[model samples]
Target: MKIGILTSGGDCPGLNAVIRGAVLKGIKAYGHTFVGFRDGWRGVVDGEVLELPREKVRGISKQGGTILGTSRTNPFDGPNGGAHNIKMTLVSLGIDALIAIGGEGTLAAAQRLSQEGLKIVGVPKTVDNDLAATDYTFGFDTAVQIATEAIDRLRTTGESHHRCMVAEVMGRHAGWIALHAGMAAGAHAILIPEQPVSAAQIATWVQEAQRRGRAPLVVVAEGFIEQGQEAAHSGRGLDTFGRPRLGGIGEKLAPEIEARTGIETRATVLGHIQRGGVPSAFDRVLATRLGMAAVDSVAHNRWGTMVTLKGTSIESIDFDTALGSLKTVPQERWDEASLLFG
Candidate 1:
């Protein structure tokens, strides 16, 4: 069988590991040939491809990002889009199956395409760790580690200047990143989208921390909304998918925190830093295992399913099951972290 693979949505660490794992396992175990689609769905729509031989995947497990590249391109849009066109393209390339490595949006698209008769297997790839079907996803650990390190460094400066420090991590609809990083960094306050927090309450926490002769450290998810305040709009505008560009939450919150608490506050948006660099050992192992499992799914003809992590095991799940809802930070987990807050 000939398989095609593509990475979609936001770029992340361990993407290359998935590609390498799939190619190595598929070729050695099943003698299946592979082709990589460039720039996500746009590559399929435009028929852009690159050959994926076993030698091409060597030494990419520690590498970040995808060698085939990625984009937010929706395969159903544009002039040469739709199921028929994509199917025709695949037929022309002699590709029998597709291995899509991406987040919710990518998996949802693959689900729709599968319904339209395209054989596709999904591999969940979100740094937010928000997918409901999986206990955790690759890239989430690396992102958390990065954010925790940034907060650790920021704490020193905050203590020296006796100023409040606000660090922002990525989490669109879930608070996993902020919650984990905040707890790991011993933040005085942690804010997330799931739980809207008032500025006054945050100020109280900051003041309490100051009263204890400690510099306040607040960790916030980018999707976190302040009570009674409108969401901060990014100057960068929208992407091809029509979703508003997310950012500026930390920058917007910093001044508000300073104003309310009467303390100097600075915001550091860990923007793309969390997604770059070498994959953590945990992420590499998980991504590689999922990648190999994806090929096994393909061999078994398990189309329209995604590989997921359930505890210490790798499993396959339906796309709808995975994309049905986001795996948000539970209230209990938040409450546990809250116990440490000022």
Candidate 2:
């Protein structure tokens, strides 16, 4: 059997690990030949490929980013896209199956392709940890670790200047990154898309921290909004998935916090730093497990299925169930973390 693999959407840590795991497992266990589709679905549409031997993927499990590359290009767009074109392309390339490693948008596309008779399996790859049917995605741990480290560094400078620091982490539809990082970094406040807060409330948290003679550190998700306002954005156009280019919330919140709390404030957007680094021990294990499970599912002809982390085990489920709903940070979790605020 032959397998084609691609990494889609935004790049993150543990992506190379997934490629390594799938390629190694498929070759050793099933004797499957592997080809890599460059730059996500565009490679599939344009018939771009690279031969992936065991030597090609060796020692990449510790590396960040992807060996096959990635992009946000929607597979349903353009004349050469859609399931039929992709299926024909796969046939001509002599590829028997595919393993798509990505987040929600990529999985949704894979779901449509599977319904249209494509032999494909998915490995969940969101740093946001929003995908359902999985307790946590591969890159989330690495992202949280990175964010927490950045926040910890910001804290030292904040205390030296007695300034309020707003650290923005990535979380579009969910608060997993912000919530975990903030709690871990001991931030005075944690803002998220799931829980909107007014500038006044954030100011109050800052003031309380100031009164305690501690520098205030506020961790905000890029998608966090003011209580009555829309989600934060700088008018940048939507991505291929039609989601807004979310960012600058920390910059927006810094002035708001400084003005209200009478403290000098600074904004630090962690941005892609969280995505570009060596995978954490946890992410390496999780991504490897999911990737190997994906090929196992493909071997069994589990079309339309996605390999996911169900508690401690890696399992496969249909995309519909896997993409059913986002795993947003629940109110109870926010409530529990709220006790530490300020």
Candidate 3:
């Protein structure tokens, strides 16, 4: 059998591991031939391709970013989108199946293609861990660890300056990174999108910490918007794929906290630093397991299914189930994290 693979959306660590695992197993166990689609869906539309073999994937499991590269391209929005051309190109290339590795947007795209009669399998790859079916995505742990270390470092500087420090992590509809990293770093407060935290509340927290003669360290997700503030970003106020922009919330919230609390405040947006780096040991293991299971998913003809980590084992679920809805941070989880707030 011949298979095509592509990585889409924001680049993250452990992507190469997934590619390596899939190609290695697909070749040795199943004797399958592999082709790679470059730059996500654009490669599919234009028929840009590369051959994947064991040699091509060597030593990439520990590397950051994707060897095949990625893009935030939304194929559905264009008049000459790849979805239409993908079917034609696949037929011409004799590609029997596709393996799409990405987060929510990529899964939704794969589901759409599946409905169009394409043989596709998906692998969860969000650092946000917001995909519904998977218990945890590959890059979330690594991102959390990176953010936690950054918070730890920033806490020192905050203390020296006696200033309020706000560290922004990534999360659009979820707050897993902030919650986990905040807990790990002992942040004074952690803000997430799931919970609508007021600027007044944040200010009060900073003020209390200051009164107690301590610097306040806040961990915030980039997608977190102040309850009553307008949005600011460069994507025409759109998100990664034309949704209303939710970025710069940390930047917006910083000044509000400073004005309200009269404390010297600063913002540190970690931005892509959380996404680019060597995969942690945990992510390498998870990505490898997901990749191995993905190839097994193919042998079982689990078309339109994605490999997910549920508890201690790797399992497969239908793509529709995985993409049914975003796995947002639950209210209870936020409440538990809130105990440490202020």
Candidate 4:
């Protein structure tokens, strides 16, 4: 079989690992030929492709980002787009199937394409770790590790200056990164989107930490909103997918905390940095396993399915199952982490 692969949506740390894993396993085990689509669905619409052999993917497992690059180009957007055009392009290129490695939007697109009779399998990719079917995604571990390191470094400066520090991590619709990093870094307050916290509550936490002779460190998810002010804190704008851009929550919170508590406060938005570095050992192994499983699923004609991590093992599930709901930070998990807060 000749398989075509594409990495879509925002780039993450373990994307290259997934690509390498799939290519190596597909070539060696199934004798499958491969081609890589450039810049996500745009490549599919425009017929832009690159030859992906075993040699091409060599030494890429430790690398960050996708070798074929990525983009937010919607597959059904312009002229020559849509399922019929994509099918024609694949047929013209002699591609038998597709492996799409990306987060919700990409997988959702792949699911629609599969429904249109396209042979496509998905591998979940997100630094947010919000996909429902998977226990965890590839880039989430690396993201959490990076955010934790940032929090650790920020703690020293904050202590020296006797300031309240707010560190923001990514999570547009979820708070997994902030939750894990906050618990790991021993934050004084952890804020997430799941629970709308007020500025007064955060200021109280900071003041308590200061009273206890410790510099306050607060970890907040990018999507976190203050109670009763949801509509006022919009980020830059909407993206190609029509979702509101999320940022500046930490910046917005810092001044409020400072003014309310009468303490010097600073906000550091660890934007993009968490997703830009080398993946953690856990992410690499998990991505490789999922990639291999994706290829196996494709070979077995499991269209409309995605490869996912279920606890200690890799499993394949229908795309709809994965997309049915987002994996959010549950109240129990948040409660557990909150025990350490001031």
lDDT, each prediction: 0.92, 0.90, 0.86, 0.92
User: Tens digits of per-residue lDDT for model 4 on 1-342?
Assistant: 999999999999999889988999999999999999999999999999999988999999899888899999889989979999999999999999999999899999999999999999999999999998999999999999999999999999999999999998998889999999999999999999898988888888888899999999999998887898755356598877777888998899988898899899999999999989789999999989988998999889999999988879888999878886999999999889887888
Best by lDDT: 1
Candidate No. with top TM-score: 4
Model 1 weakest 10-residue run by lDDT: 227-236
Q: Across residues 20-84, which tens digit of lDDT does each residue of candidate 2 receive?
A: 88989999999999999999999999889999999999999999899888998888788989988
lDDT of 4 at 123: 95
Q: List the residue pairs that clash in candidate 1.
A: none
Tens digits of per-residue lDDT for model 3 on 1-342?
Answer: 999999998898899999999999999999999999999876776678999988999999999999887887776656546566778778899998999999888888888988888888999999998888989899999999999999999999999999999998988778899999999998888988777777788888888788888899999987776677554332445556657755666677788888898888999989889998999999998998888888888888888899999998999899767776888888888888778877
Backbone N/Cα/C clashes per model: 0, 0, 1, 0
Model 4 earns a TM-score of: 0.98
Residue 336 of model 2: what lDDT? 98
Worst 10 residues of 4 by lDDT: 226-235
How many clashing pairs does model 2 include? 0
Per-prediction TM-score, please?
0.98, 0.98, 0.94, 0.98
Q: Stretches of candidate 2 above 4 Å error?
A: none
lDDT (C-alpha) at residue 91 in model 4: 96
Candidate 4, residue 3: lDDT: 95
